[model samples]
Target: DQQVKQNSPSLSVQEGRISILNCDYTNSMFDYFLWYKKYPAEGPTFLISISSIKDKNEDGRFTVFLNKSAKHLSLHIVPSQPGDSAVYFCAASAFAGNTPLVFGKGTRLSVIA
Candidate 1:
């Protein structure tokens, strides 16, 4: 069984719009979350992250919010640009920075210009 899941396989938003990507996890132990964005053949690049201690974290145009009670998390990108088009993966681990992470299949986001 998959520990993490991105229910939407794909999403599209016009340039300058807000893009929201959702993820759900089955493991309640998961307390740390990371979001990665990947383009085509390139490796997934770290985007933003949030710890269970906090409900929300933001960096520039990116923000990730964690809902521990619901076992869900979301990544939001504002003023989405064409360059932001990529596959976004949601990863989680019970421990922070020491153990492996369970990753979702990913959601392909297309920002149309």
Candidate 2:
């Protein structure tokens, strides 16, 4: 079974609006949660991340929220721009160093001008 899951296959939003992406995990051992954004013909780039110890983490226009008890997480982007259009993947890993990240299927977000 997949340890990470993104229920929404895609999302669409108009420019300057807010976009929210949801994710769920089955692994309780995961302490580090991350969100990656991928564009066509390119690799996924790290966006924002949250540690299990913290409920939320933010970087500029990106924010990540983690709910350890529910094994769920979500990513929020405010004032969404056209450049924000990409496939967002939810990932998780244990606290151990060098551990490989487990990724969700990903949700495609489209921003309309």
Top candidate when judged by lDDT against the true structure = 1
In model 2, where do residues sit more than 4 Å from their true spots? 96-98
The lDDT values for all models are 0.94, 0.94
Candidate 1 vs. true structure, TM-score: 0.97
Residue 67 lDDT in candidate 2: 86
Per-model TM values vs. the true structure: 0.97, 0.96
Model 1 lDDT tens row, 1-113: 99999999999999999999999999888888999999998999999989899999999999998889899999999989999999999999886645698899999999999
Return the top candidate by TM-score. Answer: 1
Candidate 2 structure quality by residue, lDDT tens digits, 35-92: 9999999999989888888998989999888888899999999989999999999999
Local error of candidate 2 at residue 30 (angstroms): 0.4
Candidate 2 C-alpha error for residue 13, in Å = 0.7
> C-alpha displacement of 81 in model 2, angstroms?
0.4
